[model samples]
Target: MYLLIASDLDGTLLLPGDTFGAFTKSVIHSLNRAGHHIVLATGRHQTDVESLLDSQSLPVHLITSNGARISSACGGLALSEELPASVVRTLIEETREDTDLTINLYCQSGWLMNREDRNLRDFSQNPGFQPTICATENLPLSTVQKVFFFQRNKDHQALTRLQARLEQRLGSQISTVFTFAWCLEVMTRDVSKGNALRQLADFLNVPIQACIAFGDGMNDADMLAGVGKGVLMGNAHTELFQALPDAEVIGPCTDEAVAHYLSKHLLQSTALPA
Candidate 1:
């Protein structure tokens, strides 16, 4: 059977300093040798993702901008989902009062933000990162998949309050979550990592029942619920684990538990029953 393995990047796969552990790399190589598929599903844009992979010389499919875009690392095939102009207009109007907050709009062309947001400027300077900034109102709305706010400090109370206000006003037409204390993402009502993973399954001609997903954030919830096997990081949130109690909870992403699990189960054919 063919296996599809998808995971989030920042807090889940790449640790502090944009590092990938030795065991994880070894397991990923083994999985690739076994013909399994590997995918990077992240809140980054295509350019940002491409540059990162290019720097590391790793080849994999990508689901970026919180499931708004899908592309192959081999340099072919791409799809994007964007909210309607009316929705974008409403979002901008809604955030008008919060000048201290920095907002970023993601589209096929690239990332956009108000140039005056110093925090945003700092974030864009991250290694191998580059984003295009254009007028938000003039952006091509059809290619957009998500909007995000980046805060400098890990102020949970501020993030919670901001998310709450957005939810109250947007109601069911929009979905919001904080992937990290510093980042809050808003997606279209129908967009999610699960949806993107399903799309990827179709593109790769694989069954949903044969796919495995790993994550450690609220954004990972739907992906965890939708896949055949959902694995959470041991250090994941209590509520996230409770929400998917039946799913596998491996050790923290940095611990090589995912590698251990794969080595013991999927990597060798002898593990399969006769």
Candidate 2:
């Protein structure tokens, strides 16, 4: 049976250093040729995810900004959930003095950051997908889809504290999830990969039970736990495994595990008792 397959970008589909393995590309192509649906659900801005895929056009749908925004294969925006402008401004003002945390805004147009991280532009064949350096006070809050708190040094403790603080302060006013140990993302209270995935399945008239997804981060938790088949990377965050203990743990992303698994199930023929 055909299925709708979704994958998270950074730690699930892409290799370290934000690169795609050739084997992954081949598998994606084969899956497409076999008529299965492919979707890339990521916390990244759609442009950033597009930068990685370049010209492949593998995904039938793109879930960007941790599900704040979703786009169809024709590059048309389908759904968008924006955070409250007042809340965005309030958080920026409150955290403006925190020097250790690098704040970024995934705006409707492009990525805006308080400081410049030049390494973010590496190897992207798409020259237009660069980060825009901006002062915290001048962020286009109304158009911002996601505000992310990034720990440049990858400090887990700092992230944990920040996560707690945000949850306590915002309560149900906003939603926050850690896309990576170093990156905590805040969005509209309704935003989540799982919610978006279910919406897409319904829009396309497909059953949610026929959808399978893969991920390796806390932001992926909702979708992983909600899908029919949830595959967690062997190298996924410890909390992720503990949270979804029943999920199928596959090999590490470094090994192109998603591709290998798809190859086995999609290419090889199935057998039944005669």
Best by TM-score: 2
Compute the lDDT of residue 84 as modeled in candidate 1. Answer: 67
Candidate whose lDDT is highest: 2
**Cα lDDT tens digits for candidate 2, 54-130:** 77656568899999988867554488898888889877876778887878888878888898653344323345476
Clashes per prediction? 1, 0
Q: Which regions of candidate 2 deviate over 4 angstroms?
A: 74-77, 117-128, 270-274
Candidate 2 residue-wise lDDT at 273: 14
Q: For candidate 1, what is the total of clashing residue pairs?
A: 1
By how many angstroms RMSD does model 2 differ from the true structure? Answer: 3.1
Error of 2 at 135 (Å): 1.3
Which residue window of length 10 is worst by lDDT in model 2? 117-126
Each prediction's TM-score versus the true structure: 0.84, 0.89
